[model samples]
Target: MIIRTAMAQINTTVGDLEGNKKIILSSIDSARSAGAGILLFPELTITGYPPEDLLLHTGFLRDNIRVLKEVEAYTTGSDTMVVVGFVDFSLEIYNAAAIIQNGEIKGVYRKMNLPNYSVFDERRYFTPGSRPLIIMSGSLKIGVNICEDIWVPAGPTNDQAIAGANLILNLSASPFTSTKNLTRMSLLQTRAMEYSCCMLYCNHVGGQDELVFDGRSTAIMPDGHRIVARSFEEDFLVIDIDTDQSTRYNLLEGKRKGYCKKAEVEEINVIIPQRKHQEFLPEETYRVSSEEDDLIDSLVLGLRDYTKKNGFKKVVLGLSGGMDSSLVAALAVKALGKENVIGVMMPSRITSDESKKDAVELAKNLGIETFEIPIESVFDSINGLMRPVFSDRTHDVTEENFQARIRGIILMGLSNKFGWLVLATGNKSEMATGYATLYGDMAGGLAILKDLYKTQIYRIAKRINEQTGTEIIPRNVFLKAPTAELREGQKDQDSLPPYEILDGILRLYIEESFSLDEIVSKGFDRETVEYVLRLLQRSEYKRKQGAPGIKVSKRAFGKDWRMPITNKYRD
Candidate 1:
């Protein structure tokens, strides 16, 4: 009864069947090499967790179940038993676990509980499964649950326990938001102690938009000691259990179902050599990084995945001599290798010599491709087209924005021709305050650092240089005060408050969802706080149109940060 179990807590992209299958196979091989008999994967590991609207596509479900079968085939002829998650659609869709042994599909268990609260909308996509599976893996009577199934007291596990299950395994794609681990650990202990069975919990790892599955996957003994545990940011867990340990203690009984069916004490214990036990190795607990480090790491991870997933070998970004573009160019070099990132410096009439020099030096230092595209002639032609109709007003923000749009259009044209996904570099500070020119800097498929504030952007830049120890970003870029350079000496601070104050207020207001009065009461000047609040309140529509930015914080301006744009409620 020396049962060996492994947890492959991996990071998966939504709808990435091929990529996920590859990663899963690698983990399975690793597990087999480690002499593990049973390996557990996260919920929806095949088609990725929370496939969202993709579940609406009939073809997607058809394909996902097909992939699960192929995965099942790969596990053939090996002594290892795999219990991985995927969507199963017969008459209806189900959050399911496909248990495979020797290349044959043994038993499939549909998740009994579908959590439909907050971030989860599984009830919308999947029909509730009725039963828990307790399959035979050597001497272990292994009961299987998915996510929320074990969190509840009475459910499929009760039936399985009644049917004689000595061990319960739960698979999850549980998200991290403050204090989630504490809650999970508390419930796991309660479940193991109450059920009088060893519990194995496996979860997904890494960032998926705002939802980062902290894969602190654990295995609790019947006596409530966490015997096996793995940490966040992806890893595998291996647990060794003495199955006969259950026979060493008395069995406790709970009702078979929600109803008062007669309780039965069911215990199945097979003998094992009680010689040695594998000690649990605990990984260092992760502390949240500074805001800038968080944002930078998020962008790097997002860019790496987006490019790698899309089958792009190189990244081509338009780097202005300005902060936004400079930040993006540097990040691209980091994400993709420096050789794979190409930077284009497009200068208009407003471009400074310092800006041009800085851009060139940045590309040179990073060893990336840098090309200059001056658009003075393009602007002159566009101005000639508009002059006949607009004779009265002198040039303003519109004229400045026309240059930006031309840059954007040209950059996209290059991206189209060269197969580069243009990375827009508008920070959250600009996006929230509407400092970005529509169809101008906003013209890109992915926004590399959009969720970051301007201050956070600088911090990230500084941190990058600190890590690299070379002159990647020009020193002047860091030393000089911030400006969009839209017009003659137009600065960001001229329009918006100081980034220190602005980002501070924004974090409390946007991420924390603080009211205006409450934010003002946090020892900030009332008028500035009110103005910033009003700006944030009004610019929801613009943010909705911003590029797909990497989510680093608990509340990014993505699906996780939904608000009504037409709402009249304000302070």
Candidate 2:
């Protein structure tokens, strides 16, 4: 008999029980209509994944349990066995999964492993379960584990397989990083092969704060082969599994479980009258599948979710007609609607005519609103104020910083009056070398492009325009030599090395966490490396003050990265 399973890749918000319940019920109904015998959900699909500090509140945990009971009551008459993740409050709190068959909960599986390091903090909230849970269906014996359980080589799945489990279900809320799906598939396939059991792995999808869960749920045969895989986005995947003639089913173990349960306890035995058997052909189990879209989809989704969920109706950008700000404005328009984005052209005396003209043309091409705010007056006012303080010294970078501060205060005023979220457009190169002015251009409700390198920003911008068949980002921005335009002849190359050279070293030193001597030994000039390293070290405080952006890469300036501002040890 072929047992059909549906994996629901549902996106949930933390603490939104009513909404989560509606979604869960809808998915179960969908799966049932699709002829699925059982439906699987991700870890904490009810209260959402990584409820974080909310788990610390006792009332919150109580509410989670309350919803779980309500959901169990809602499913009493349904034939579909729905497996869902929740927080259970018994004598102690448990990260749990309830197996609901025909509207009543048959069994529950609490998560055994609690990840405490990196982005996970499950150990801080609840006590780990001591054992694996195996539920006895009419014909199929299913074992269950939570997110971090089967990722290990010697976890509960192994023990459950030893105890004669024919199939294993794993629920998770694994967040996306670089090449995470590849690693996940490898590990899950390894576990399936090692345990010789049909494995079903499900993960939640969507963005919650800085975290973006990539929902690539799948069902695998025992021989480390994929039966079917779910899509990355919100998907409802159903696959047929023939337990009797399935490739992964162990006949000896299935017969052994039919006779006994444990060493001492009585086996869970049920008497069902036999029905007439019909000749059967093996169901078609497809091989491994792949959905490889361009890398831009993830960046676009991450940006879109982060902006919309945060409740920002409109975004304001400081477009100097420069590469960074222009790319940012284009991305903002792409993420949010073009009408929702405003590009402000703030020009001082030092701003070139091409910069002003390009800004206007770019705004026109994108069909976004634009405003010209001349900062020459503000610069003159600030300079007049600081003239007496620096009576003897010639005009310097501090003078140029005044122009940026004026623009920042103006943006803040607009933000205050219009309730628009400001998107800071500083790139990783500028942010790394303290080349940016804190509380100046750095003041914003969100920093959309902070983590991206200068070269990467240019690349994504060009690719966007090329793909769209329109110049969303004008070509002039890319062609022009990058400049802060703070002074008359100030250029980026004059202050720092070219982005091609700088970001290359930065990729190894910052992102890869290479040591100073190690970076210097990679054929870079030692003095330049030392200077850039020092600048990066000193600019942690600047990064701390910048607005939080979507973490597209492995590490952004948000929660994923942590750097000390005051440190004594230096190379």
Candidate 3:
């Protein structure tokens, strides 16, 4: 027997019930047209992943179930069994997958593991299931599970396999990180080999707030061969799996592992007739993307989805010709196109001629709309008004930050008048150390590089120029020393350490959670480590008020780093 399975890696909007219904129905039609015996979709396909507090509403849950029933009605007379994710409201709500066939729900599989770690609060909304589910279609025994169910070593997948399941179907909304796909693939392959079954993994695609899901939905064969879908984009993949191969491997493996006669699990038998083997072209394994490519793609998708979903067609950013803003401008153009990106150069008296030249050069190269707003007169006017209050104080960081706040005001004014979303340019290095001024550069609707360190910004910039085969970001932007140019002859290194060293210590402390002494043991200066750690803690309040940004790293500041603003513990 041959089972033709279709995995729809889809992009869904939270609380968009009608929109999600259309997508799910359209995908079901496409799958049925391809003669797939079974179809799989990503987790939370009806309501979207991480619906957050929206789940608290009773009407939202009822509406989601209504959409699921509509889907069930649409699948009437079709032999294809659809496994779709939705919120099930029994006595209590559950993160669930409903197995629909022949116009009625055959069975429902509630998620066993509720992940409550970084970016996930499933435990708050869902009741974990204690029973494992297996679907029986003729000789094929398939296991159905949700995301995070198969991640554990001894999760429900173990029970389903012991019950003689030859195929495992997992629906996921796994968020994109730089190195997460590699880890996910390895885990899937290990499960396939150990269980003597093919693993079908479907993940959501597109950005929801700061979380972007890279939909690399894959089919891992029992022999460890994989057929993958697209990355950072929605894709529909259909593949034929030979049951003979799986059955043979399962027989040997199950007997070797001393398979039990009565496995503790629930079984739902559905009559899904096997479709005739349609010889389609073999699917090639997706090419391994370079780290630069992954980072660029994730950022572009995140920005594009956020802007579009939020109903903004244009984006505005302050371009200072420095690395952070310049790189952000380039990415904005890539995501929203040159016509929709507005580059505003709000130069004050201290702004250098070289900086002005670099900013203009970048705008011209990228062909984005440019606005040269000189803020010196405005700065002087504000300074004169504050001269009496500042009579006791001399020139210091206060005067320097006045310029940044002025530029921020201009950008916000443009955004307000033109309905353009302001994209904050501050990266993780500045955000981590509280180097950015509140209501100043940190003022925006979205922060593009909040999860990325300063050194990582330079690397991405280099990669952009290298791939485009042109100096799109300008050569001088890379050559010039980093600076805010708020005062005369100022460089970032004057206040903060070199990015190479600062970023190294930050990675250890923030991502690795290394203590001060442990970080110092990694060859960093003790004083510098202590200073960086202190700045990180001191800046927690600032980060709480900053714009939400895309998360492309293992640990982002939002939702991932949860430190109290008034904590007194010093490391």
Best by TM-score: 3
Q: How close is candidate 1 to the true structure, as a TM-score?
A: 0.82
TM-score, each model?
0.82, 0.88, 0.98
lDDT of 1 by residue, 524-558 (tens): 89999988878887888878877787665556677
Give the lDDT of residue 322 in candidate 1: 69
lDDT per residue as tens, model 2, 491-539: 8999898888888778788677788888888888888888888888888
Relative to the true structure, how large is the alpha-carbon lDDT of every model?
0.76, 0.76, 0.91
Q: Global CA lDDT of candidate 1, please?
A: 0.76
> Which residue pairs of candidate 3 clash?
none
Model 3 ranges with Cα > 4 A deviation: 251-263
- Worst ten-residue run, lDDT, model 3? 254-263
What's model 3's lDDT at 308? Answer: 96
Model 3 quality (TM-score): 0.98
- In candidate 1, position 280 carries an lDDT of 34
Please give the range of 10 consecutive residues that has the lowest summed lDDT in model 1: 266-275
Model 3 lDDT on a 0 to 1 scale:
0.91
Structure candidate 2, residue pairs in collision: 75-103, 76-103
